[model samples]
Target: MRMNYEENAKIFKAVSDQSRLKIIDILSCGERCACDILEYFDFTQPTLSHHMRVLSNCGLIEVRKEGLWNYYRLNINNCNKLTLFMMNLVTETKDCICNDKSKCTCK
Candidate 1:
């Protein structure tokens, strides 16, 4: 409950976009340049840049520049943190919350 709700919301929002999620999927294969990613879609450069910017702001992806091209890769630490956060959410909370309002001490 004390977590940074705004930051977590930003991550969720960024990944909510189909384009951004596809970008993550592309990066999962390996690090790729903007040109490579752009090739997979029919959107214009500026539009793709916009999507990339959103993903970067979410702390999910990192980009590096090489000459004129930009390479994108997943931020393993942040990704791991998000994954662990979700896992903990599922594991910590008991399933029968509504039925038993007596002794729920699993936090």
Candidate 2:
């Protein structure tokens, strides 16, 4: 599904969670099975599955089943959409000038 701006914002917020961010970082490298993801975390199978479900729900990741294995793939298209939006913001807002301050709220 094509997520609108609000929906995509919710997705970014979801991925802001620590564990979820780690999951995305791992997937950023390449696709991995559910079992493989579980091996690196202290969470139980159900917990990891829940995190995967959230990621899938946000369209940040795509999933597939292969016999007894389930694989997770990064939704790079969605990622590109987000990246482009950020790039556009930086490009469009030519005079934001908040970056050079000692401390900025945008951070």
Candidate 3:
């Protein structure tokens, strides 16, 4: 499968932050309520909300509402896509970008 540079970049950028990385790690175990996630960090609710928004926007994590609470979990499909993308990025495949000499600007 081909990888979309722009979309993958967004996913990488979202996880670039330390806080967001931690949030992703936390959600790896299972779905967690917002309150439970907050306990792992010293940040405020608004900050956590911001992290969740970034994660959700990048399709890294998913959220659902139960009453007044919000629960979050890693998006398995997207996560697998990311894993495959990373592997393809580092591995020397027939379709690797470097294999296209015409795209090279320098002689």
**Leading candidate by TM-score:** 3
lDDT of 3: 0.95
Deviation (Å) of 102 in candidate 1: 13
Runs of candidate 2 exceeding 4 Å displacement: 1-4, 93-107
Q: What is the lDDT of candidate 1?
A: 0.84
Q: Tell me the lDDT of model 3 at 9.
A: 98
Off by over 4 Å in 3: 104-107
Candidate 2 per-residue lDDT over residues 1-107, each given as its tens digit? 22256876888887888999999999999999999998889999999999999989988899999998899999999888887766655563534444446666564
Candidate 1 — which residues are off by over 4 angstroms? 93-107
lDDT of each: 0.84, 0.83, 0.95
Least accurate 10 contiguous residues by lDDT in model 2: 92-101
Give the candidate number with the greatest lDDT: 3
Candidate 1 collision pairs: none
TM-score of each: 0.80, 0.77, 0.94
Kindly list the per-residue Cα lDDT of model 3 for residues 30-90, writing each as its tens digit: 9999999999999899999999999999999999999999999999999999999999999
Q: Positional deviation of 15 in candidate 2, in angstroms?
A: 0.5
Residue pairs clashing in model 2 are none
Q: Mind sharing the TM-score for model 2?
A: 0.77
The candidate 3 region of ten consecutive residues with least summed lDDT is 98-107
Candidate 1 C-alpha lDDT tens digits along 34-104 = 99999999899999999999989888899999999999999989988787666655564554334376776
